[model samples]
Target: MTSIPDPVEGPGASPAVPGAPPPQLVRSPLSDGEWHRLHPLTPLLRGGLFLIVVIGIVFANLRDRLVFIFLPWLAPDIEDEVGEWEGAGGDPIDFIIANNLYVLAGLAVLAALIVLVAVFYTSWRFHTFRITDDDVEVRSGILFRTQRRAPLDRVQGVNLTRPMIARLLGMAKLEVVGAGADANVKLEYLSTANAEAVRADILRLASGRRLSAAGPAGALAPPRAGRVATLSQTVGREITGLIEGPEAPVTELESVVHIPVGRLVASHILSMSTLGLLFAIVAIVIGVSQGVTWLLFGFVPAIIGFGAYWVRSIVRSLRYAIAPTPDGVRITFGLFTTITEIVPPGRVHAVEVTQPIMWRPAGWWTVRINRLTGRSAADGSTDQFTTALPVGTAADVERVLRLLQPGLPDDERALVVQEGMFGPGETDTFTNTPRRAWWIRPLSYRRNGFRLTPDALLMRRGIVWRKLVILPLARLQSIGLYQGPLDRASRVTNVRAHVVAGPVSPFLAAVDRDSALALFDGVARGSVRAAFTDRTHRWAQEETSAPEPADLVRGAESAPAGASESAASGTGEDRT
Candidate 1:
């Protein structure tokens, strides 16, 4: 481990370059520049690559050098013992350490030079930054110092990182992302005050775009300075707001939601699986007392393992929020070291809403978005954040879906409601004795819907939680779609509903074979073209196909009693 270097003191310490307000100092145990130091694994990454390259180069040049050293040792080895080769080679160690000196010295110098260049570049070119009212400026560069600027509108997201060193340094590196930012924008390094000040000012300056929570109770933001008394306009107002009013900034924090204290602890620590810190701690204590230091170390981290896990759980389980902005969506999580992510809505190509076996009863949902460019955790990367709500309920999902693609069909509100019983809703809904079905496989067919006809059977079954994946003919990616052998033998044919999932982003859903072929022909032959076009086609300006018929019963399923406001109110009660 390297020793701590002295601070930049004495003569050449540059003055605080004028820019945004200096970062406010917070009471924290880490040191300046502690955040940017490479992760312990960093050197390994570079060193591993270097080792390969260096070895290849050394081996390439080894023959000539080997001959030079071996000439002297050849006589001794040949006389003393049966040499492997015809020559008497010199003392292996002596020869190796001798002539290898030049090669070693050259390597050392090259490495030292590379290190010097990198450090110089880092010191001179590196800088942290913030956007100010007048301009978005940066202080960066190593040997050749620089301070550059652009307009605030040109600025995009501000990424804050605390490299392992930065964590220890008590300071953070800030990068102001923009359309065309410099490669190395680490402007001001190792300055805790500068970081916070820069971050706050940038936030305040662009305060116009701060994210807010959804719903009536969410943001208590005051009206803008000029628009306070414009209340009864007799219509609706679509004014855009960036930063919310003063009251709910903490709501900007995603970890503010209240999880039942008991469940939060249990889910993260002491559930039946017992894989959380409780198990680790219990195991650690037992191992340590038994004088099994190696074993204890094997399971848990020495100084900070348990704390990290606890902190991670708190960050995930608390106040969760997903907001839609004009440009993109910003998702923030964590408490001590908060993470704020910004993803543009335009780039979003697909979305996945999943409920795992355990989460089914919890009424929790997790969503993941497929962006054309940004990295996703689902595929595999450090960036696994959801573009929309990653965790929430049916209502939350609805709100986010609406936000994701505004102006979606209002009539589909009922479709969304119908899906409540249909999807992974609250646990009590499924307590009516799980149904068992027998078909190709026991678990494959969970339930049977009343046969609309003998030739067709509606089967609903899943290994874990049951799902009703519907398939309709009109949305097939391939009209000539066919069924496989397994499906045909069961007298059941699997047909795809849509090649995609979602109103905005569609995916394939498999259904029985008879339904598949029938639907395919119906759609392919354009038999249901007129009706299908009218209902599913959002872009068409075609009029309603037929006149509306009066409801025979007042509270019929076709027309329910209360409005959406009432439904929302009932769901809102338990959300908090």
Candidate 2:
């Protein structure tokens, strides 16, 4: 691949315009106690949160806004307090009693409003995410300061979210995704313009070069924009593989799944605060007399969330396209606001075909990756990568998997899925079965369960949501050759496979241990052999492979007496 331009070394580069001394670095707002001017999109995007809270506050103080307007009407009813009695035309004692409380309440409201404005100002000035030549930096907080600097090498990709407000303003929020010390550190929420700049800068740094935008103070990148043609290409690619030839099959991909907006809205209404609901009910009663019914206003947020969700569902998933390119996998979609994410194929750790219960009949599956860097705020603090595939078909899944893990099984990219909804006796690459009284019934109705025996280990999950886990020798984290007291009579043993958070069998449940050692050695070797230097790609493609004897199930030895703790990471998400 040709090298990126050397902004520092290019001869034509604006030769330090032979003027005064080269400009020096300016102080950051954090140091100088000045607010850093942020992306213009910042206010509009975050304004949603404030607006939510503010509306509540304003409603809570409804009587206050209505005060002056109603004061004229209320004043005369107040025992002729201020105007008549306060002028000594009425009883002095009654006058004081009537007006004093009102005067004090008004004074109190003015104080509160002033305090509210100060808070809003400070909050707006605190959080910031900037792209630097070397890394992405987040400087946030006011009293107790927090600054995060994540190396560009640690950056996974810029996750762009166009919230309702961002859509209105043509802005985007950028997440600087990297594995934080505990999980992944993400510099969240940048303006659209700055978001693009930061994304480009990160990409530029990922390329192992300092961009001209880098100065003592990192320069803000105008949002790195993908061309409309580029987006169309990405769209086509998301449909097909870009980097890989268009021969791979799509596995667990869903092309068409109708979003139930009404259901979503109803669910939200059902989930609202009891107090809010009661208020709406009260407003309905008041509407019998008052022309202005507050009940109507109560539905605004639900409507907004409803619209936002539907729009997100439609636009985000609309004509969604995925393709393999020379650099990595590119995904494109959106009706009103377009977003395209390019993921370098090699950075992908693992790929999975996730079929949630709701998406089952619709044949929708979400394809997600455990990538190198970045996490969403939702999935704890670490990098959690996901591409919710509206289309979940085996063919789509295979195509995506190839892009994520190219050459995983080079023989053939597509594998026919064997039907075994009732039990675990299906394998595309190897014969899988649940013999030896191995399966644990998750729910009596569904055949999904955990299974472990000396011969082969598998976690059979799914009836409504089906998942079959077949852990062969190569995938075992460490074989637990143990049998519980009750299991002693059954003469069965279990093995646990430890896979890290990134790709490759992350957090799989139990599996038996026949022919596991071979599988373990093979996968471990595969990991070592697959490690590459280039670490980047554009498009991904298709291939189909059938089960081979090499996909063996290795039996495990009993667990060491105290090896239980070591198995925690590989155990089920249900801690109980």
Candidate 3:
């Protein structure tokens, strides 16, 4: 691996030319393994904007008081009004005015402003992050210091987020997602170019690939430009993005699927949440008309909250796209505050394709996955992180799935979407529940079944809210079979494939007893075989010398049959 050349060194350097701009100095912080400070404007972008807004509100409210104290000549002519206002409260401004401490007050405000500026500047200076071959680390503190690290090998994904304000400033944030809850480390407010460059570096390192002799393409930071030129370029790009769409990061491949605006809006409108909102409105109108006028207080706020949530959901999905990259699948979404998430190969534990009863008419479906993002639901944005395809047609779902699970064979991919999600039990390849199990799930019994493939296990269930769950053999942690009293009497069982904690549930209910036994046995042996042979965690290595799809399946099939049966029947559980 060769060190990246500094912009001022070797070929990057140029002789001075009269009347021409000087050469720009570009630095590659990621390659240096040294602690680097965030953007100088980080504090302002993070919290100073909110502080400015708060100050503006306070200043507006105290406008008259300020005028009376500093500009008596411009004060309102209503002396009685001033007296009445002063008499109503023990206000600090009144005390300052009464004591004629105007100079002191001015000094105090100026001192506070100075202190605030110092805090912001100090905060920006103290907050620094570094990237190395093994981990990404961040350190921050004023008095109570804190440090966080995300190991490159354990990284689940990397996300680059550009909030609206930060986007306009040509800045973005990078989050290196760890495998455990609340384990993510973030580097907030880097230049857009640097953020993208750092993101590429992290993913590249995590993929077990060294920088090539020529240096990774994304490692070369753009030449730093003059402030005026930089600002103009940032604004121009932002305006263009608003009209067209966010520009694809250099690391992203061409999108595998594109979700149209019309389709996205229609999907949300037809959702059960929207239907519930409509019903609530109807009920509220009826209640108000029938002498319950007080309902307005609650109804108004409820409507606003629901409308805001709905609109936000739609907006966040506006520029949604999924693409394959060298390191993983890159999912990009959001209209204004764009986010690009890179989910590396083998990090995904499970995949699910679902369709609500309402969506069936329009042939729309959604795809979600089980992956450790190291963020809990409290983050509020976890849903966006887990959703691979928010809403799309069957073909769109297939394309997204192929990008997400590249090892899945072409035939298996077709079976997953066509048979696993939409096929009837009789004609599909899945081993479906027997008719006797109909009593357990009357409506969905015909659709409920499980299919075992070489690389994954597909479980299809639900009629009104259809779902197809795909759990890769390599990621399966454990397998269990359950038979409640009712299931025992019906000669049926439930099978659960446990993986990392995530939104997708990989459990199939009401499976025939014998079929469940076989599934348990097969998965027990297959998971072990797959785990031993799985090299996807170091995806770059696999990419360079990967076996054929058929060979992978064949490799997983060679596990001893006796070991699987014994493991499955003895404890009624198999731990991978």
Candidate 4:
């Protein structure tokens, strides 16, 4: 219940020394460990429109009855003539009108409005959220109350979403993504400015940074206009954003990658979904020509569904852009309902770069990652959530990869793009599937391979639909080597790196048996070492002069003597 500071008169209000930089004012009011209500118009914004629609539908259905009830004097002459018709079919409302109980009916309507207002007011009052150093908590409901909390350490990422309606009202929602499924906590309908400030405060707290005290003397704070002026400014900004685009919450670094509309449209047109739709349409055409009319019913529904999905996909990627920030990667997407997701360092478990055969001509690739989204499959579109780069050229992919994996050295970045993405089996760096194993993977034998770096494991596969998966050692949960009868006969093995559940699959198929064994040993030992030395979880607190990539690679290669023994006895099962 603490009052927010008056921006013009609070700390940092006076002018500082002539040459000194302006002091940074504390912008967040909700981070003071007090339970705070959401936006004042949250109730109306959340369901007011729905309530109006429901009332409109009811009035439409009972238009005549309502007219008679409210204005009985006007319809008095017609009622007597239709009394017989009404007696047989009319309900309690008609009886009320017939008895001239207009006051009673009006009272009933008034009562309903009162109840609705009370409910909405109480709901808004009860629904409160609190932000502390440890976690973000939200409490709601009157009868079946529920409380949800997201711990700072377990926070996977933070998403700020502005739906079309909410954006019009200059409001945004904050979803604090936790480490496990369905663990996300949402603060719906906060003022846009406050939402941005709260997001920064939460991320700062999660990053192990303490809030600064009020500014020193002569440090002038930014001026603030009156509430009326502020409201006008917010409205203006929202209107401007509709024509332009939503502004980013944080200061983005240079070199941001933006996908072109033409490329996005073309990529989807040549996608597997489009191809499947084409085949379905051909089948439908053939069926129609063969005098099968019943197929049209099914085909129409399928077409509608496919069209809807395709359009949604394109709309979501309309304003797609990705850039780096001090926290991690900032990804913005969507045309109407803009979502800005901040994925901090060390959250990404696995990264995959894939190229469909059709996209190969354009040298375009799609990048996705495996990370804890704190949402179930049924909650939302997990595909869109996991996709980092929807459709971009090879250069765009490289730039996005750098943002996603900031620790990756220049040499490793080249290895990822050159060897993992486009290189053939002739490279010495990658341990490829042996020629004897060609029968099992005839099409991709020359392209299938795996490479190791100090920070991650890279698995490249497929010729028609090329894929490269990168799994960071620190995030790896377990490693496994599989060899079935066919694999053994082909003198090859399959390796899988287990991580969080997501879109990226880390399984590599058809690797030379000896190379697979060596990979298993190295990964097991290196993962253990990486886990021990990993400091990315609290990156802000880590030492500035970290080891170079080459030194780390060398250290991984010449791991301690105990590392090998531990890895040999570890749970990396090599099943035959």
User: With candidate 1 superimposed using the best TM-score fit, by how many Å does residue 284's alpha carbon deviate from the native?
Assistant: 12
Off by over 4 Å in 4: 1-26, 59-106, 210-233, 253-255, 285-291, 425-428, 542-576
Off by over 4 Å in 2: 1-36, 40-52, 59-68, 71-130, 181-191, 207-327, 330-343, 354-387, 416-428, 437-464, 468-495, 500-512, 532-576
Global local distance difference test of model 2: 0.43
- Please give, for residues 1-576, the per-residue lDDT of candidate 4 as tens digits: 333321121222123323211223224656656567888789987778778999999899776665665687877765664566467755776677568777898899989888988898788877888776678988888777788999888788999999988887789999999988889999998988778877876776677543253232221223677878877787888878977888644577443787788888899999888889899899899999999988888888989999998899999988888887766788889999999889989999999999999998889999999999998878676677799999888889889988898878998998788888988636558877888888888898878888888678999988898999999887888777888999988878888888888888898889988888778777776676676567666656645577664565456558664454254322243445
Best by TM-score: 3
Candidate 4 least-lDDT 10 residues = 5-14
Which residue pairs of candidate 3 clash? none
Candidate 2 structure quality by residue, lDDT tens digits, 214-326:
35643433344666754455356533332332222322233233334443333233333434656755766677468765656766576566657645554445546666543
RMSD of 3: 6.5
lDDT per residue (tens digit) for residues 232-266 in model 1 = 22012211111121112432444223335455454
Steric overlap count per candidate: 57, 106, 0, 4
TM-score-superior candidate, 1 or 2? 2
lDDT of each: 0.39, 0.43, 0.78, 0.78
Candidate numbers, best TM-score first, in rank order: 3, 4, 2, 1
Q: Give the TM-score of candidate 3.
A: 0.88
Return the lDDT, model 4, position 518. 77
